[model samples]
Target: MEQKSVWLDEIKFKAKPSLKEDINCDILIIGGGIAGISTALELKDEDGVVLIDKGKIGYGVTSHTTGKLTYLQGSIYDDIEKAHNFKTASRYLESQLYAIKMALDNIKKYGIKCDLEKNNSYLFAAYDVDKLDKMKKFLKKTKIKYEECDLPVNIPNINAIKVNDTFVFHPLKYITSLREIIIKSKVQIYENTRATSISFEKDYYKVTTLEGNIKAKKIIICTHYPFFVIPGLMPLRLSLEKSYALLSPYKNEKFNAINVDDEVYSVRFYKDNIIVGGFSHPLYKNINYKKEEDKLIYFYKKYFNKDIEMAWQTHDLTSHDYLPMIGRLNKNHPNLLIATAFNKWGMTNGILAGKILADLALNKQNKYADLFRLDRPISFTKVTNFITNNFMVGKTYIGTKLIKNKDFYKNVHIEMIDGKCSGIYNDENGEKHIVSNTCPHLKCSLIFNKLDKTWDCPCHGSRFDIDGNLLEGPSVFDIKLK
Candidate 1:
């Protein structure tokens, strides 16, 4: 009934628009969430940069995130080290640390009132008590310095392994601050701008929107889930992870002094508000949003004795190696770069990505650029990823061919080639247009989620408007006709 910005509801502003005529820019950044805004803000003073958003800025996945900027991604270091030796894992860790620093510096420089706070982050144990041991061993192998602690939080049936320090801030406030700077820098911020098509000709990237077009020396596919499928091959490598959270009823109402890493759950407090999050599931074809919400409710009822206030659900782009795919979209599309699949760890990652992508766009050098490059090899241990990720994507292909017969209404969810996800709508027009059927994220085939009129993705859990435009990510593109 009531809609407001998640953590920072006080923010108010109007969504901007794309230029209606041909304009040249040094770089074109798509998707105006934290990532796009960060890039545009970083390069705003620099020439030839324009940022566009499918909707309003800060309304994408960045808004729904439990913003905890930290290096501790609870119970991930062990797998990271195991998947690709300690050395490479250390690189990933260091890269994340570098991102954290970038955000800190910008916050200070801009004097952003994003409620920036420093605290110790935690990854506690619920089931496997030895999870911390693997992290310890991995840290030792990498020769990284970290301190452990007994967590002081009051909760039932929990054990804690402390990460030295972590940070939290109001992400929307940070993005809003960047938006102000970008506006002042003369980088156009276009809200409600949907990029319809993109082409590369004569080494100039041309992005066509419903209203106009833009020509740029380079293009960035930061629209959460990329619009075009060719560059990132996002359909194949990334799967959708839908998660839920609740913000309400302060207990000690203590904010996360340090980021807390829990796969099933994450805890943080914003002033008097406590945010409890977790309930990650594959957002595949026929994925149940209600089931996802029920899980969050179960966790809430079990843990806290308070009324739940604001609740939100969102999806993340999870990659094969659990890192992220940044840098060029593909070799053939050299001038195009992509930033997606952040594993729901977007704030710092996105900040670092702005720097790395900005440098690459400028053809300058960035050391970690190699770490997140698009063409990085998928290692042997990650072969399992290929199968699991592909399995999810297969549903899209199958969903596309459900049935064409008009009477095929029993299982009527189908992805039309015209990019429409249609139901049997007897419109006032007295006929059917067979509206946009493609999942907004990665153009996956959407199966009719009987429980919800929402079409569900088998690859990533991007929902859509009945017309097939984006309702969620990793896709920011809505399914609409040309």
Candidate 2:
């Protein structure tokens, strides 16, 4: 079985050159995932616009998505109403619908063949029927057409709500097609170009990258989690969760379903494979990643009784208010825009963020800008959640620092090498790989991910390979021992 995202199979695109010299542009985007690529597509016709990624485009969080395009998210409207108000919930729903339309429009206009298929989206609940009822009421009030039905696939559920006019597509195909268009346009793209720091000049911002520096009149940060905290305090405003996914060969099903239970299970299909995703928890809370993966494997075996073909995992950022932050970082930094915290529904939110961010960058007014502005009014729920999330982060940070050499695997252990704390992993070939055990982002202790053979940060979500090369990050530096 492959330890990678199912969407990454067979799709290939040419790699773009990384920035090799100091460069200047009118706008510089600092990520290449859906949010970044979508933003670049919006500004493709604009002059002097550039996009750069630490890795290849469409290979980050976007590749790991389930790729469902529907406004019938699992109890999102109800959750939003509880957090804010009905108006906010309704507006959020509208934004999602509009984002879906935007995606459809782009697919049609570009003739992008991404295996787009129309399907019914189902939201089921095992014990939280009240939550499902509230969502149904919201859909009714908003004049959306839905029907009470059983899940199309055989899974444990008490009640379900189904909505038509929704769709799913291959996420990587859609993204790579967009990349092709942007490449042929005026927008410049750079892969393997990591942005390390940003300094504010009098009239512009300068972004320091690995091999070069970028000076731009405007900047947009679409990185999953902004590496820095000053302008937005992203670490305090966001909490992250990691989820496991596996695919099995099965008959194609035209419907996708997600349960509203505490341990959510989402199911969809691609061609002849059944994709199951669930087993979500607060990121880095439990370091036993292999056990977590085993739970997913057991679920697939129990339900579908099929052999797993591909298995992988992904991390998602959630906001205190359960809304995406997609506007100016702060009033003082109007030229600096950001889009983050998709709340596990990045396919739609990322597309909408692109529109909102593009509009803001061009000095145009987007209708939904006020709804998701970074500096919007904080509610009682947001304040409480903010405290709760940051408290856990603080606890994890301190707790990881205090613990030393707690072995979770036989092949991996922490030890002092040359008077420095280091992580040692014994490969199957009986070779030892060693690196610093400290996360460069916030100095949190690194936990070995046994399933993937990597070091993962428990406080933030920064990840590194066994050799201590940074894989994903809020950290811009590698953890290799000097």
Candidate 3:
């Protein structure tokens, strides 16, 4: 099946100019998805704020989300409270509400036509009664109003907690509108210009790309995953998971909904279609991407009787502590900021990060700043997750590297080139393309994503085209082609 989001086809965006020479700015923001673009919008009034992306704005993982804008995320409050504290979870709730208001206000102010609709959102459960009870207790403790209701689908014995005044919209449309506003303001925007590396000079940071270098007083690493590895230790603290979504004609599904099952499913409506998204799992060697996609379709077809219109996939980084990490990159690098690990709640978290990051850069005080501090102290709550995630990383590194077999599929094989690992794919037209199988970022062996026909690094979320061109990265360089 072809892998493309239904949201991508809703807007026809004009191309922006790519960076071709070195430039100086007050602040440099990298990554052009929701977080990067929203940060640019917040900083537009400030002088000399520049943003750059490897691809076009709004085309990354943001384009592939379910696009639900709700503060009542599925069991997020319970998870955060368990991982951190009640105060931290409450602050997280505040940030999400603030983000939703910010987005809605901006859409109204800019007259953005993004199909925004006020739909109730729900957290439902069939078998996970304990989890659902915990969510209710958290909601009650926070004083957020919710109601018990029947499941919207045909599923039996399922109950849901619903929050009114929530919303759903076309994310690409909203992002495109925001991009236009930022471009018209003081922000300098560039696309197709990747930030390859960063170095500190006397006082400022120099971000270099193939096109040129950008010298800025402050740098924000908003790329889905920060390319810098030293202080953040992102690989040790995070894990990558891929999720699938299917869009098809709708019937009577009313509210945006998700369940609290181990194998979770979230369904929402857009245009005349119902988008059912779920089937998330950690990235690992020899996992069949096609089978994952099929599983999503099968579940949707079993529940709803509609022909699938489009199917797609998205990848996300989940922080070990469950809450997002947003603040300075480390204790020493105050001028460097990092925002990542939204835990599949990027829509609200990304927007909220923009607000928090802008405050940090502009020297303004944000109430929720300390809640998401990158230098947060290690606690007993975080210890178990840290050990489990890091152990999995080690397993992925050693396990994928040890596979020496050449035969993968009929046309794809792993072999040696110049005494190093290489993947060779012979297309239907009999053209041979060979590229390194080792990720340039951490040397983790790459896995073939058959559904997208890209080489994916299961360890750090780097991706490359079959032709050896970098698609997404912490790895700024492409796989070596021979």
Q: Which one is best on TM-score? A: 2
User: Which regions of candidate 1 are displaced past 4 Å?
Assistant: 1-5, 140-148, 154-158, 253-263, 396-421, 424-454, 466-469, 472-482
Model 1 agreement with the true structure over 362-399: per-residue lDDT tens digits: 88999999988978887876678867767756754675
lDDT of 2 by residue, 1-482 (tens): 87888888768776898899999999999998999999999999999999999989988889999999988888778788988999999999999999999999999999999999999899999788888888888889999998888887777888998888899999999999999999999999999999999999999999999989999999999999887766336787889999999988999557888887778889889999889998888885776877888898998888788888899998989998889989999888999999999998999999999999999999998999999998988888988888887888888888777667666578888887888889899999999999999998888988888777889898789999988888898989899999
Per-model CA lDDT versus the true structure:
0.72, 0.89, 0.85
Ten contiguous residues with the weakest lDDT in model 2: 227-236
User: Model 3, range 222-267, lDDT digits (tens) per residue?
Assistant: 8998886864367777778889998888867578988777778888
List of clashing residue pairs for candidate 2: none
Pairing residues by index, what is the TM-score of model 1?
0.86
TM-score of each: 0.86, 0.98, 0.97
RMSD of 3: 1.5
Q: Per-prediction count of colliding residue pairs?
A: 22, 0, 0
lDDT value, candidate 1, whole model: 0.72
